[model samples]
Target chain A: MVDLDVEEPNSGLFVKGKLEETNPVYKMVPVWEKDKCTFCGNCQKVCNFNAVIQLHTQVLVFPKLCHSCYACSELCPTDALPMKPEKIGEIKTFHQDNLTFLESCLNIGQEMAVQVIAHTNKILEKDYQGQLIIIDAPPGTSCPVIEAVKDTDFVLLAAEPTPFGLHDLKLAVDTMRKLKKDFAVIINRFGLGNDKIWEYCQRQNIEILAKIPNSRTAAELYSHGKLIYKQIPQVKQEVLKIANKIRQLSGEPK
Target chain B: MRIAFTSQGSTWNDPIDPRFGRAPYLLIYDEETDKLEVIDNTAINQVAHGAGPETARKLFQAKPKVLITGNGPGGNAARVLENANITIYIGAGSLTVEQAYKKYKNNELKNY
Candidate 1:
């Protein structure tokens, strides 16, 4: 399983894996050299993200806003704005029995989670020899989540059963439909909220594979960084059912 | 001394917008000529990010000696103003442009 939520890679908290390999990911940012700069403002003008600004006597580059496009660094006449690789995030590979876990984490002040996620996917594609890749994508349908699920065979959306949950679930459904991805839903805390999500799923013709029961025991175990699949019989049954469906979708024999 | 204020409208009576980057108009008040120049910030508003620094860059081109605004500039915008040698006086969000200017002169505004 790969945790593409680099901003908050919490899957490591639950998965008991021994650390295997670690790698640092870097993004290029234009570093302004004081003496060589003519202050011509070309770099500033070329920057579409407003990452570079030419003041009266000095040039300032905002590292966070920089998308690492290399426009300013490449177009500089004096070579004052040289491109430098700055460490933005790190990737860790772990092993637990036969399962290999890949987790990428962004640095505290890093603005680009998509960069880290893309890098993590590259690592998974190149290094890992796993047959079935389960990707735990970040919540919401933003750039990072899109990057996570873009190449996946199937997406499993786990949702709570509430008004707010239904609202976000609709957004996720819309996004999935727009992406033209094959996906199924899993209603978490099933007995808690009204059956609006179920009704909505039925209307949309979305297949709900399983419903994990609302259990305080599961929540308690999760808070302590424990996996409840073994301890909680209900959660284990639902998870096993989902696993079987996923295997079937992937054409894996029972 | 030239002073810059981020305002909602082009007039002096317009309430000072607390936001430096996304303000509707940037008003530059010239002390010597008693003239006011309004800069349209609609372009900055349309940008996805770095609005603060972009707005700061525009404000720098106007050559304002000081900036008077509501909550002062944020991290990225503040860095630009600091490098440009421009002082920032804040707590003008609740005041009008004229009142902010008066407060700035009275040293009643907080220096950011």
Candidate 2:
């Protein structure tokens, strides 16, 4: 299992794993030399993020605003801009039972979640030995989600049965269709809200892979960092059924 | 000198647009020839990000000496405009594009 939620990775809280290693991710940012710079303001003009600024005699570079595209450095006439690698996040590897867990955690105040997520995905692609890899992607239909789910075999969209959930689910479905990825919907907290989600799924011809009922006991177990499947036998059976279905769909030997 | 104004319509009688990046049109007035040119800005409305910076870059290509808009440019666009040595004037609220340009010419508009 791999968690690509770099902004807030919480899978480690539930799984008991031994931390094996951590690797830092870095991005190149431009550093300017004041003496060599003529204050022509070319760097500031070329920068898309307002990372570079020329105020009177001094030029300031805001590392946070820098997207590290190297446009400023490349456009510098005097070659005063130098690229420096700045650490943005870290990827942690762990061993839990027979599964190898990889999680990407972004540094505090870092806005580059896609970079870390892409780095994590690259590491997985190079070293992935498992037949079936379950990736827990970030919640959204934005760039991060697209980066995480792109080129994957199947996308299991989990959502609540509320109106907000349906709205977001529709967006996710639209994104998936646009990306042309095989996907199915999994309604979490089922029976708690109206039947709007089910009706929409039916109307859209989207497959409902599984539905997890809303249960106070299951919620309590999850809050305590306990697996709901392990606490509830019925939930365990449902999960096993889902696993079987996935294995059958993916053509993996059970 | 060339001056640019964000406008809601293509003509001089159109209201000054409050937005710098997502405005429907850019009304460029040339002081040398006393000509008015309108550039469509509707393409920027569909952009999800970096619209301000892109618009600033487009304006920079035109080499405008002054930008007279109803609203101040965002941080990204401001950097691009400042780097290009283009002075920005604001407070053209609820006025027509021609009125805004007239106010800017008369030094009645505020400079940020």
Top DockQ prediction, candidate number: 1
Across A56-126, the per-residue lDDT of candidate 1 in tens digits comes to 77998999999999999899999999999999999998899999898899999989998899888887778
Q: Which pairs of residues collide in candidate 2?
A: none
**Predictions in order: lDDT:** 0.91, 0.85
Give me the runs in candidate 1 sitting further than 4 Å from their true place: none
Interface RMSD of each: 0.5, 5.1
For each candidate in turn, the TM-score is: 0.95, 0.71
What shift in Å separates residue A92 of candidate 2 from its native position after superposition? 0.9
DockQ of 1: 0.85
Best by lDDT: 1
Instruction: Write the residue-wise lDDT of candidate 2 on A1-254 in tens digits.
Output: 88898899988888799999999999788998988988888897888665776655667676766778899999899989989999999998999889888888989987878888888888877888445788889998998999999858899999999999999999999999999999999888878889999999999999988888789999899889998998777677667767987898779777
